[model samples]
Target: MTTTSTYDVHTVRAAFPILQRTVHGGKPLVYLDHAATAQKPQAVLDAIGHYYRTTNSNVHRGAHALSAEATAAFEDARAVIAGYVGAARNEEIVFTSGTTDGLNLLAATVLTSAQPGDEILLTEMEHHANIVPWQMVAQQRGLAIRVVPVRDDGTISVDDVASLLTERTKVFACAHVSNVLGTINPIAEWSALCQANGTRCIVDGAQAIQHCSVDVQALGCDAYVFSAHKLFGPTGFGVLWARYDFLDALPPYRGGGAMIDRVTFSGTTFNAIPMRFEAGTPHIEGAIGTAAAIRWLQEIDTTERIAHEDDLLRHTTAAMTAMDGLTILGTASHKVGIISFVVDGIHASDIGTLLDNMGIAIRAGHHCTQPLHQRFGIDASARASFALTSTREEADMFVEGLAKAIRMLR
Candidate 1:
């Protein structure tokens, strides 16, 4: 798996300062937990610091100069994010605390509109963020929940999803990519199926946006949600992109100072599409830093970045596959740069602990897809995921460390 493209991974690594730091008794850090959250670059850090240093003011309310500047920067960031995701308009991109906050907000508002006996479709590979919110809504509203099963190969068939989209299905929520398996779900096909069945298609894109290109308009999904932290930006901020018409029809998810059109003793009218959902003081610096991250990533060639990650995935997978008594969990033809695996006669936690002592960071346990783990007949799996900044050297280090751990445990 060689890449012809000239992607300078060292340059990419230099951008993230933490990658240079040694950890746990002076060992070089080999970060393979990117599926959990990506490390931030210097540009993102500078953007956040600059905001507090110079333009520290509330957005969209005050008449002062600082307020106006802050508002301009905030909205400009929104436009940049909207363009990145192929949104129809900036108004359609609603800011939330994170992917979890956005999905919970959707469940509490839009999904709540379903009547009793209505069906909500989901998949087995969904993270708890996607599952629990819908479960809570279904329980409260008397809506029935249906799940598309994950096959033995860790992929779900488009036909299987089509079979589950019934006339009673009001919402079909699925992940753009599985956090554990790295299987890239066929979102466009599923979205089309939901369209014909008159169901709202909701996508959890927390894992997809950073690894590959995402176009909400091209996918034709009703809504897409993702987090900034997963994209090398600050935590506690994300975007929920939806059709403007759909957003305009829904009532406000929360009530606060910035989300009002008019307020009186009688009744109050709400603000516009995005602001209506973003109640109270928003994460101002978080939005600005996210924009910086988006710009930094865009500066790199997309083809080269993706190819670098794929190369790492192939190289690592080949090395691990040749090792005895180890099984790769997901064999989906379509995948991102993630590998979940388990060794014979060893607990995933023990593997993680040993890797930590070597200054290698990998996720151990269910990876937030407990049902997916159950589907595989395992309680947990160890995951080593890659990013554009990850290197072959790091992959080799991780493999050597894993082999040593296995020998010691066995």
Candidate 2:
């Protein structure tokens, strides 16, 4: 179970109880869908359960000691995440339901300052979370949505995005890493270009945060968005870290109890930056768990972890590509430990089903990048995304399962 010169992966695997058992019959679960959602580790689970059992209370509202404790822990979690992403201030980090909610909140809030002729630039490799919210708002505001094209190798150039920018371009948003293609977008380069053009830059870090280090100030994006669950935390929790300048002026996305300051029959005032955007009772335990996930990540030698993942990527790519008629999609040189492939004359869903029967979980279909799939002339592709605990054996199992599936299908 030891990978590379990296630390013991078996030790890491021991932290995840679910990795212990087999799924159907005696088949070990080769969970390769980390890009979709990561399995929570024991630290995350313990943090959440401990919170609900020991300090359950309504944060920022209640008067008692339990409430104060919960509030402090929740805000502390925000600070941890803010530091993790290198945000300028803790107030810049706003908690949302997930990546979908974070992107929607940001898009809605920023639209409050939009004019009729504004343009929002997005890349073709963006997840639907980054595309749909902008599309909905653009439709309503008469704004235009322009896409930065992806290359045949599943990578994008900053020059391509810059070519599309103009005086009318108010915002440029892109995913830091593509979920399907695993292309690592040059966010800092594009952010610098957008800033020079007087445009706001946003980065969707859902896929990037888990794979590599992300410093928002270093990335120089006006805003950044990511989900905690994809990084080994609880679902229903995400972070949207915006620049300090945008935090004060962006309008609130929802109206509810905690987000408001004063209410009147005629008009109501709102709370400060983050609280204004985070409405209703927040997920207190979810926040705590997310902090634990980040803490666990920090505990590991990240260099070693990344090296292990890179080894997995290289191994999987070689094994899968060695099979005849099996084509690996998105052969970007800078991709992370995710492999998307298609077997000729075989359906992706069938491959997924057969793998599932073998206790192997992978993502199938377009992976929410239908436009990318369309560009590649494929309706779907089978994706096996690696995580911290992924090993050479699991990679071999995945390739062997797919080979068996392809033989049967053909």
Candidate 3:
């Protein structure tokens, strides 16, 4: 459990069984798509299996023993996530499907507080999950939506954000890390600025949480959202960490049995902070799995893990940048463990396919950030995202496969 041995990358890789598996005629699977979805460790998988096999029951409804046990496990998961994100209280953590679901929930509930002509501010570097929801809300309520521009290097300009902020700007939603560019935005600074401007800040921490430590209280954001799957947990479960007062004031996002205090022909009253947002049958097993995963991550030394990945990034970036006709996107000084690039005269899909055949799995396309891609005048790019389990050999394999693909295309 203790990784005291000078950041052993191979030791970490050994924990994930799927990493050794082969595809494409016995070729080793070199997974480089951790940003899209991380492969689960055996600990996470076993935790999930353990939940369904042993502690399977509905939570927070019945007074039965099974329900009590299930509720304890579910709430324990909430506490663990709260601790991970540095939430002030467990009541501030609301469970959702994932980052997209968390964002949509915010859009739905928070927009109810907005009046017509109020602006919702977003950045150009947002993924579609962040962009589309705000667009829908803007369209529905006739609220003006503004965008804070990103610099050529892919970092959001604080100056542009300051200029864009007006009294009418009710909410400012930004990504903590750019999925395509790997740019780490100044969330803490932006959060402070939004606070001064009387704007609520909602941060998408799906990528950032995995790369670095996230403390929601320290970041000073009104709400921070991330997915469990991205943090080596089960899919279909995520966390929405909101300020306690904000969570109390905001209306319920979904309507169902557990979220209501009373149901009558006249109307229904909603429950308190966390429970108010979580409706119907919750993903009890997923929540337990998430807690287990968080515990597993907490067992390792994060500082060393981050340092190891940083080294991998530097190595990969150097190798890729040296290649002829390769253009790396998002050269921000501050970045996550992701590299996105396009080879000249090669379609991203082609690059991805060729790499896949060589047992190097990567993501291709605009990576759900068409606006950001349009800014760079490219259709799409090949992305290689690393995790704690990634190795130097895997990074080298990606660069080697990409070089071969470029030659094949030419």
lDDT (Cα atoms) of all candidates against the true structure: 0.93, 0.89, 0.90
Q: Which candidate order results from sorting by lDDT in descending order? A: 1, 3, 2
Candidate 2 weakest ten by summed lDDT? 1-10
- List model 3 lDDT by residue over 249-302, tens digit each: 898877887899889999999888799888899988889888888888888899
Q: Could you tell me which residue pairs clash in candidate 1?
A: none
Clashes of each: 0, 0, 0
TM-score of 3: 0.98
Q: Residue 141 deviation, candidate 2, in Å? A: 1.3
| Cα misplacement distance, residue 4 of candidate 2 (Å) | 6.5
- Give the runs in model 2 whose Cα sits over 4 Å from its true position: 1-4
lDDT, candidate 2, 1-410, per-residue tens:
34338478888988998888899899888899999999989999999999989999999988999999999999999999999999888999999898889888878878776888899999888888899999999998999999988888888877788899989998898899999888787788998899999988988899998898889988999989899998899998899999887878888789998899999989999999889988899988889999999999899998888888888898788887789998887788887888888888889999999899999999889899888888888999999999989878888988888889888888
- Judge candidate 3 at residue 259 and give its lDDT: 93
lDDT of 1 by residue, 79-180 (tens): 999999999899999999999998998888887568899999999999999999999999999999999999988899889999999999999999999998
Model 1 clash tally? 0
Off by over 4 Å in 3: 1-5
Q: For every candidate structure, what is the RMSD over all alpha carbons to the true structure, in angstroms?
A: 1.0, 1.3, 1.9
